[model samples]
Target: MKFLWTLFILMALMHTSSAQQTQKPVLHGKNWMAITGKPLAATAGAMIFQKGGNAVDAACAMLAATCTMWDMLSWGGETQALIYNPKTKKVIAINALGIAPTGATVAFFKNKGYNFPPEYGPLAAVTPGTPGGLCYMLANYGTLSLEQVLAPALQLAAGYPIEAQTANSIERNKDQIKQWPYSKKVFLTHPGENREAPDAGEIFVQKNLLQTLTKMVETERAAMKAGKSRKEAIMAAYDRFYKGDIAREFVRGCQEQGGLITMEDLARWKPLEEAPLKVAYKGIDVYKLQQWTQGPAMLQALNILENFDLKSMGYNSARYIHTIYQAMNLAFADRDFYYGDPYFKPQEPIKGLLSKEYAKQRASIIQFDQNNPRIGPGDPYPFEGKANPYTALLKKRGYEMDTTKRNFAPVHDIRNTSSLIEYQQRLWLGTTSVEAADKEGWVVSITPSGGWVPACIAGNTGVGMSQRMQSFVLDSTLSPFNVVQPGKRPRVTLTPSLALKDGKPFLSFAVQGGDTQDQNLLQFFLNIVEFGMNVQQATEAANINSNQLWLSLGGTKNDDRKPRPGQLLLNNNTPETVRNELKKMGYTLSFGDRTSGPINAIYFDWKHGSFWGGSSNYGEDYGIGW
Candidate 1:
C-alpha cells in the first residue's frame, strides 16, 4: 500500500491530539443499531434504521455500503448471513455463497498444468452472489425496498471520501487492477494519468460503479411500470445480474479472458435458505452458518471445550490457551477433511459432524499437561464401512495437506496489512462483517467477502467475480471442500454468530479474517462469558491464532513443510508469562503487534432493556447505536 506510510504519519498525529487513549469499546443505547468495518457504512445502516427500517433492512444496507467502498471485501462476492426473525422466534442461515461454473471441472485446470486457478484473475472467479443475496434478504424479510436501502451506497458511489481503508486496498491492488483493461479503467484512472489513491479524507468518485448501480435502478423501474409488484421489481434487478443481460456480460467477460463462468451457471444460481448449525455452550445457544463455511468448526471447538472448567483454568492462561488450541486443532482437522457442501456428499454426515457424542469422543484425546501439536482429522463418521474413501484416495495423489500457509511479513501495524481479502488474509488476515439489531428483537449477522485478490473485476460492468472458486479443489479424491461441480458452492470461511440466553436473543457478533474468524469469535465469547469482560473490553482484548499447518481457502501451493496445529501467534498484550507457559507445553509461538482476528459485537441486556456495542480499533470496525 503506497499511501500506508503517509496514513501512519497522519494517524500518529491524531493520537497525539488526545492526551490519553482509552481502550474501552464504544457504547450504545437500547434501540436499533448497526456496526460494521467503517463509520461511514455504519452510519448508512443507522440512517436506514432512523428511517423506520428493521434490522434486516439496515444490515443489507450496511453490507452494500461496505461493498461499494472496500473492493477487498466485495463489489461482487459471497455474502453469508445469519438472521434472527423476531416473528418466527428463530434464526435462519442464508447461504448466499457463490458457486463454481458448470464448466469448472478439475480436468479443466489440470490440463492447463496448474494445481488450481492463479490466485486472482477471471479464471479464479465464481458467479457473484452478493447482489442476489441482498435482493433476497430485502424481498423476504425487509420492509424497505432495494432502492431505499441501496440509496446511500448509490449516492456514495456518485461521490464519497476515500477513507483510509479503501484507499489502502486500492493502492495494494493497483498493479493487479492494471492487468485487466476494464478493471484498470474503473479503478485505476485519474482523467489523463494513472490513478493515485485519494488521501484519507479526500473525496473520491466512482463514476463507473455509479453508472452500474443506476442501471439496476433503471431496470427495476422498468419492471414496476410494466405492472410487476415490488418484490418482482427487485427480482428484476436480481435477474438482470444473475440471468439476464448482466449475466451474459459476465459470461462474455470470462470467455474472453480464459475463464469458465457461463450463462447457465449464473441463471441457475439462487442463494439457499438453510437452518443454522446450532450448538449450546454454557447454557447459551450459539448459531453459526453451516459447513459451507468454517462456522461449524466453532461449534465443534465449543463442544470439546465444554468438557473442561474454563473458569477454573482462568482466561488466557497456558492451560486455557492449550485446551483451546487442542480443541481447535481437532476441530480444524475435521474442517479440512470433512467440512464442505453436503449437497455434493462432502463424505461426513451433518448430524455426525456436529453431534455432541462425536465431540466428546474427539475431546477425550486432549492432554492438559502437554500439547497435542498436530493431530489429523478424527473419525467423526459413525459408520466406518459406510464412510467414503474419496478424500483419502485424493491425499495419495500428491495434493499434500490443505492448510493455511503463513507468508507472514515482519511485525507491523495490522492496519497496514488490511488490504488483503479473505483468502489472502489467511496470510495477512482480513474480511468484512456487519451486525445489526432492531428494538423488535429482529437481528442479522453477516460476513461478506471476495472480489479483490483471488477475484478480478468483470468487463465494463464494474462488478467482479468472487474468488470463492479458490476454496474449491479440483480432484476425484473427494476432498469435501475442494471438488468442483456444476453449481457446487466452494466451502467458504465467512461466518457470523448469534447467541441466545434464556431463550432470548442475547448477543450478535462477527469478525474479519479467514480461519482466524472463529478463533476471534471464540476469544470474544470467552472474554465476555467467562472473564466477565464487557462488550467493549472483549472487542479490544488481544487474542491468539492456532495457525501452524492450516492453509486458507483460495490458498496457493506452498513448498514449505509445516507442523500440524502449526505455530501460534501470541498477542503480547496477553502477557509473556502465559506465552512462556504455552511454550513450555511444547507450543511453538510467534508475536505480532495485534491479534489476527478483529471483531465487532453487540450484547443485549434484557435486565436493563438496553444494548452495548463495540467495534475494533484495529482498522475499519465502527459501531453506532441509539
Candidate 2:
C-alpha cells in the first residue's frame, strides 16, 4: 500500500509538469478569450469577462495588469492595440505611440549641432500613449468601472514576488533607470545591490505606483458623476493630466532636470484612428496594423514568398533560407526607399514591388556561385519592359564606396581583425558610425490604472498624457524628397497583430524588436499557417532577418553602404548537409542566433473551445493564475 501511494504521487508530479507545458485556457458559450505574456494579465481579463464585459473590457483590464507586472514591455512609453469589435464586425487600429513635444524639431537639433541621441531621455521621449488609449477603449466598449479593472495592477504594484526574468531585464536596462530618480528608487536600493529572487509565495510592493493608481480611480469616478458621459469623462481625466495641475508639476520637474516638455505640447496631443492595411494570401484575408508599423512590409514579404515553394525546400535548409532572404531584400528595397505615412504623402505601392513578375525577375538575379557585389530593386514588372530605375542605379554604383566623401567617413580600416580588435576599433575609430545610425528604435507601455496615472503629483485626479514623437524618423536614406515634413507620422515597426483562420481568431500576436518586428512576425505566421505547428513550437522555431541590404543568417552580406556590395556572415550552426547542398548550387553559409524578436500570442481553437496563451519564456516574465 505504501509503495502504491508513492508511485501515485510520482505520477501526479509528472502529469503536472506535462500539463504546464501544454496548458491553455478555454472560454465557451458563444464568446472566446485569451491573453499572452503574463498569467496575471490573463486572469485580469478573465475576471472582467465574468463581470459581463466584452473583449474590449477584458483587454483593457489585461492591459492594466500587464503595465503593473511587465514594466519592460508595458508602460506609458509603449503603443496600444484593438484588433476586433464584435458589434461593428470591423477592425480598428489605434496609434497610441508617443510623439515629441511641440518644441522638438529637426531645426532645433541641427542648430544645436546635436545629432540624434542614442537612448531614451526627455529628448528621445515622446508623449506617452497608453493612458489615452486605455480610456478610449473603456469609454467606447467597457462596462465595468475603471476602479474594478485597475484593482489587480494596484495590488501587484504594492508588491509581488520578484521573478528571475524580471530581475534580469531590470538589470539590463539599469543604465536607463539610473537617469530617472523615481525609477532608481522603485527598482534599486541605495548601492544598487543585486537582489535575489523572492521566495515562491512572497509578495512585493511598489508604494509610489500604488498611490498613483489610487488617485486615477477616484478622479475618474467624480468626473463621470458630474454630468459627463463615459467617453467625455475619460477625456476629462486625460485633460486633467495634460492641461491641469499635473502637467504643471511634471513640466516643472523636467525644467529643473533639463528635460524638454512643455504644457502646450501636452494640450495639443491627440490619438488618431487609421485604416488598417489588408492583403490576400492563398485566398485568405490577412490584416496588418496599418502605416503605424511595418505591417505593409510584412505583407510585401508574404506576397513575394507566395512565388516560392518553401515547404518543399525543407526546414532551415540553406536553399530555403536563401530564397526567403532574397525575397525579403527585394521587399525592403522599396520599404527603406519609399514607405511612410500616406496621409502626408502618397506611399508608393509595395504590391508592385513584390508582384510575381518582379519576384521572378529578382530571383533570376540570385547567383549561387560567386556572390554578387550588389543587390538592386530588380524589375518591378517582369512581364512588361518597364525597368526599375533603382535596380539600374544599384548596378551602376556597385557596393563599395570611398567614405571620405560622405559627412561621416571611415577614418581607419579594421577588416579581418579578431573579435576584440574589432570591438576596440569600433569604439575608437567608429568606421561604422553611419551604419550604426541606421538601426530601429521602439518604446512599449502598459497601464492598468485605466488609462490614467495615479495622483501622486496630480492633486487627487488620476490621469496621464502621452506625447507623439515617433514622427521624427520618416523618409528614405537615399532620397532627399522623402525628408521628414510637418504633420507626418513616422514609418513605424510597432505591430499588435492577431491571426484568424477558418473564421476564428487563432493567434493574438505581436513582436517587440525594431527592424526585426516584421521578420519575426513573418516566421511565426509561416510556422502556423504552413507548417501546422502549435504556438510554442512555432514561436521557438529558428528565424532569419534582413534589413534590405544585409541578410544576417545567410553567409553573405549585401552591403548598402558602398558601391561594391556582396558581403555576408553565415552562422556556423547552419547544418553542414544543407550548406554543402547550397554550396553545390553556389550559395554561402554563416552562423547566427534565434534571437530575432520577442513574440507574445494566445492561440484559440473553436473545435475544442479552448484557449492557450504564451509569452516568450526566453525573457523576463511571470505567469500566474488560479
Candidate 3:
C-alpha cells in the first residue's frame, strides 16, 4: 500500500507539471511575423512583408487595414508606437497623438456644463493623426511605396465581409449612428428596416473612403511623375490629406456639425518622432512613450516591485497579488495627478517621477496586511531638486500633506448601480494592437485608437473623427497638469512597449483595453522575466486590474469620473483561497474568464534567428508568421 501511494503521488505531480496548455498554438516564424486585432488585418501585414517590405512597412499596412475594418478605431484616431530601428540600435517613439483644436478651452467646456469633454460626436474630436502618422512612418522608415502600403486598406474600403463584433456594435448603437448624417448614410445600408446595420459576414463597403484613398494615391503618383523622391511622393500624399481637398472637407463637415476643428488645426498638426523613455529591470531595458501617455506608470510600478522578492512569493499567490495591486495603485495615483502634455506649461516632473529613489519612497509605505484605499499622488518635485509646487493644491484637495504618509483617495467615488453598465463600457472600451517583426532586426509595436463605432464621419470623406478629447479634464483639481486648452494634446491611455535584452531586440508587445492596458502589460512582462514563461504563455497569463485611479474616459459629469477604490478584477481561474485572502484585505473583486488581454506580441530569438508570435485568446486577435 505504501509503495502504491508513493507512485500515485509521483504520477499526479508529473500530470500537474505538464498540464499547462494554451487555447491557440504558439506561432513560430523564421523570416517574419505579423499580429493584430483581426485576422484579415494580420494578412495585410503578411502581404506587405511578402512583398519584400520591412517591419515598418508591414506595420503601416496593418494599421491602415485595421482602421478601414473599424477595429475599435479609424483613420481619424490617434497613434502611439515604439519602433526598434536596427541601424540606429535604439527604440524610437512615434507621437502621432492629435492635439486640441483651436477654441477648445476650459471655459468653452465649462459654459456647456461639461465636467470633461463629451464622449461622442464631432464635438469630441481632436485633429486627425493616424493618416499623417502612417504616412510619416512609411516615408521615413519603410521601403515600400504609399500605393503598395495602402493597397489592402483601399480594397477594404471598396468592400469586405464585416465581422460579427463590429456589425453587432453598429446595430446596437444604431440610434447614435442615426444622429450623424454621413454615418447613417454609410452604416445603415437598409435604413428604417428591422436590422439596419449590415449583417455579420455581409459585404460592407465605403465608397467615399475609397474615393479619398484614391485621391491620395493619385497625388503620390503625380508627384513621382514630376520627378519627386520616394519620400517626397509620400509627403505629397500627406499634404493632400492635411492641407488639400481632404482637409477642406473635414473642416467643413466639422464646423457644420458645431465642431471646433479648423483648417489651421489640420495644417499645423503633424506627427512627431521623439525619444522614448526607458527603465532597466534586472538586465532588460523596457521602453515606453513620454508623459503625454500613461506609459510611465508601468515603469514606476516596475521600480517599486524591484524592491520585493516577487518570484519567491510565487505566481498569483496572495502576497504577490497584494504587492502588485499596491504598487499599481501607488503609481496610478501619481499618474492621475501628474501625467499630462509635456509640451505645455509647468512641465511634468518626469525626472523625479521615474526616479528609483522616488519609487523606493513610494514602495516603503505599502501596508503588507491590507489594501490602502487612501493612496494618492506623491510629491516627486523634491527628488528633482525643486520645491513641491502643488503643495497647497494637494492640501486644499484633501491629499496627504505628509508626503511620506498615507494619502486620501480622490474626491469622487459615487457608486450608482443604474449607470454601472455605461461606466464599465467606457472603462473597458476596446481598441486594437499591432505588432510586426522581420529578418532585418526591425520591430514595431503600435496601439492606435480614438474613432470607434458610432463615430461621426467627417463629410463625404467617410473618415471618422477622433473622440480623444474626452481624455482631458476641465478642473485643475482633478488633474493640475491635464487641464483643457487649445493646441494641447490630451493625456491618453494608449501605450505600446518594447524591451531589449543584452543590447538586442527581446520583446515587442501591446494591448487594447483602456486603463487596463498597463496593468495587463506589467504582469505579462513579469510572467516572462520572473516565471520563465514563453511569449505566448505570458500573454495568456492571468492579470489583475486596479480601478483606483480616476476614470480616463466615458464621463459626462463630475460624478462619472470618480474612482472606485478597492475595486480589483481577477481571473476566473483564481484559486478560492486567494480570493478569500484578497477579500479580507478589502478588495471588491470581480471575475472574468478572460480578464487580461487580447495582447499581440513578437519575441526575437537571437540565438535561433527567428521570431515567436503571441496573440492571446481573449478576443479576435490573430497573427501570421512565415
- Determine the backbone clash count of candidate 1: 12
Error of 1 at 362 (Å): 1.1
lDDT of each: 0.75, 0.50, 0.89
Question: Model 3, range 1-626, lDDT digits (tens) per residue?
Answer: 99999999999998666536777888999999999999999999999999999999999999999999998899989999999999989899999999999999989998998989998999899999999999999999999999999999999999999999899889977999999999899999889899999999999999999999999999999999999999999999999999999999999988888899999999999999999998999999999999999999999999999999999999999999999999999998999889999999879999999999999999999999998878989999999999988988877766432222211222231231224333333344467899999888899999999889889999999899999999999988878899888899999999999999999999999998888899999999999899988888888888888777776877678655666677777878899999999989988877666766778889888888889999998778899999
Worst 10 residues of 2 by lDDT: 430-439
Question: Total clashing residue pairs per candidate?
Answer: 12, 51, 0
TM-score of each: 0.89, 0.73, 0.95
Model 2 regions more than 4 Å off: 1-32, 111-115, 171-176, 192-205, 346-373, 376-471, 474-488, 501-506, 547-574, 579-597, 608-617, 620-626
Query: Which sections of candidate 3 miss by over 4 Å?
Result: 1-19, 399-429
Q: Which of the two, 2 or 3, has more TM-score? A: 3
Is 1 or 2 the stronger prediction by lDDT?
1
Model 3 residue 27 distance off true place after TM-score fit, in angstroms:
0.8
For model 3, the run of ten residues with the poorest summed lDDT = 405-414
